[model samples]
Target: MEGSAVRHFTPFWFSVEPVDTLAVRGAPALLNCSAHSDTPARVDWKKDGTFLNLASDDRRQLLPDGSLLITSVVHSKHNKPDEGVYQCEASIESLGTISSRTARLTVADGDGGSPGGWLRAVPLAIGRAPALHLCTPASVEGSHAVERWLFSH
Candidate 1:
């Protein structure tokens, strides 16, 4: 062969894979949001639709696997807004942006051993498929990516 050509391309996509997390009140908690991408991507954590300030807070830290970890879960009589829905947003140049599944963080009043408590309050679902959100650019300029929701039951 006189001349041969070989080409390689990186797949631009974002994937957040983390199951629902449960934590006891007044204990340590870890909110996971691991993202995978063929290229570099920015991962941001959000709680209750508000962006979490991981850089300024000492209690909050972004793990090496792109997951957010809360040092100590706080639940008091005065304020207990820390327990809520948490999600992670990952964005890439070619992949656009994608939001992870909403994870409900329920703080139990005790060690989760009492009957009819937080454990029992939560419902269990069978034969549920995982969700994946994706945003692909149309022209990379002045274009909005259309979203398509896919579900299997």
Candidate 2:
């Protein structure tokens, strides 16, 4: 049996590069920050200027490859606040620290389709001739009341 020799690490340094990613409203997004080094380094991600707190938010998760994964993206002021500059940093005990370029996270604005929003739901019709139903109260007393449908071209 042959014995394997343990490899030692040197002062090798690599750049941390994070690419800008686009995400649609109400969808998932992933921001990747990958790097390489002779010695393993600690990776940390920051948003806008503050360090990300992965423990507080359940929708945010830190992947094993030093990437940030967003569960759902909501383009609203009170909802998800994920639109901002993102940066990745890598540091080693023996080696030096390196930070990646600032990547902007843009969340696409979605058309507001709330119940009382401006965009109302369209009535769906299957055939050419549509049917219209008018409901009236039965407790009406009238001598000669006639209802007629008027059509205008």
TM-score to true structure, per model: 0.61, 0.60
- The predictions' CA RMSDs to the true structure, in order, are 17.4, 16.6
Q: Model 2: per-residue lDDT, tens digit, 1-153?
A: 369866566654444365665555666666766668776777788999898988788888888777787877666867658888998887887667788888887765445332222221112243211122222223245864333222111
With a 3 Å backbone cut-off (N, CA, C), the pairs that clash in candidate 1 are: none
Residue 122 of model 2 has an lDDT of 19
> Could you tell me the TM-score of candidate 2?
0.60
**Per-residue alpha-carbon lDDT of candidate 1 for residues 71-117, written as tens digits (9 for 90 to 100):** 76677667785688888888786557878888877665654344422
Clashes (backbone N, CA, C under 3 Å), per candidate, total 0, 0
List residue ranges in candidate 1 displaced over 4 A: 1-16, 111-113, 116-153
Q: Which pairs of residues collide in candidate 2? A: none
The prediction achieving the highest TM-score against the true structure is 1
After the best TM-score superposition of candidate 1, give how far the Cα of residue 130 lies from its true spot, in angstroms: 18
